[model samples]
Target: MTVTLKDFYADWCGPCKTQDPILEDIQEDWGDRFQVEKVNVDEEQDVANEYQVRSLPTLIVENDDGVVERFVGVTQREDIEGALESAGA
Candidate 1:
């Protein structure tokens, strides 16, 4: 099963910079078990709007089965892990 987390961010956002490393660590730790993809809001405005992402660091997680969950703002590792666990990651 594949678990994917997508981050919507812009280059000029300070919080996006802060959250980037955390997401990178999560990617490194999770490896192929899960993956993180980034979408630059400035570059992908339509996609961001489709996800209703109005913030700098919005995270949308989806499983291979197509179950999805959305989170706004800077999230913690534990919270992300818990969500994945709850989603049967």
Candidate 2:
């Protein structure tokens, strides 16, 4: 199945900045195993609203079956990895 990591963040959000490196590392490790879509809330309010993202850094893991995991704020590396693994990434 296709797995996707939807990262909802704004440029000015501090926690979002902190989450960036972690996501980058995950991308480096996972490569094409999954896809990461970064949504800038400031520029993409519609998309953010569609996801009902009420926080600065919201991470949503989805597969072909739909959303499997959702996290708010600055999430840990292992937590994200676990989510991806569960989603069949």
Candidate 3:
């Protein structure tokens, strides 16, 4: 069961800008263990809608077991890591 972290954001979103590097660092730390994909809301509205994203920087973590968790706004690295741990990564 592969886990996926979908990052929903837009270029003009200030908070999303702040969130980018954090997710990047997390992605690097997790390596292949985490399938992190950046979803630009402006470019992928349907995908955002699929996850019911109502804000920028919304992260939807999903896997074969289903949606493990969701985080909105500026998320802490520890929290995201904890979700990874919960996903058995």
| Candidate 3 per-residue lDDT over residues 1-89, each given as its tens digit | 78888889999999998988888898887889979888998999998888899987898887889889899999998998888888767
lDDT of each: 0.80, 0.96, 0.87
Runs of candidate 2 exceeding 4 Å displacement: none
Please identify which of the two predictions, 1 or 3, would achieve the higher TM-score against the true structure: 3
Instruction: Give the best candidate by lDDT.
Output: 2
TM-score of candidate 2 relative to the true fold: 0.97
Best-first order by lDDT: 2, 3, 1
Per-residue C-alpha lDDT of model 1 across residues 1-89, encoded as one tens digit per residue: 67878888888988888888887787778777777778999999998888888877898888877747778888888878777766566
Model 2 over residues 33-88: C-alpha lDDT tens digits? 99999999999999999999999799999999999999999999999999999999
What TM-score does each of the candidates earn? 0.87, 0.97, 0.93
Q: What pairs collide in candidate 2?
A: none
Candidate 3, residue 20: Cα displacement in angstroms equals: 1.1
- The predicted structure with the larger lDDT, 1 or 2, is 2
> Which ten contiguous residues of candidate 3 have the minimum total lDDT?
80-89
Q: Candidate 2, overall lDDT?
A: 0.96
Error of model 3, residue 2, in angstroms: 0.3
Best candidate, TM-score-wise? 2
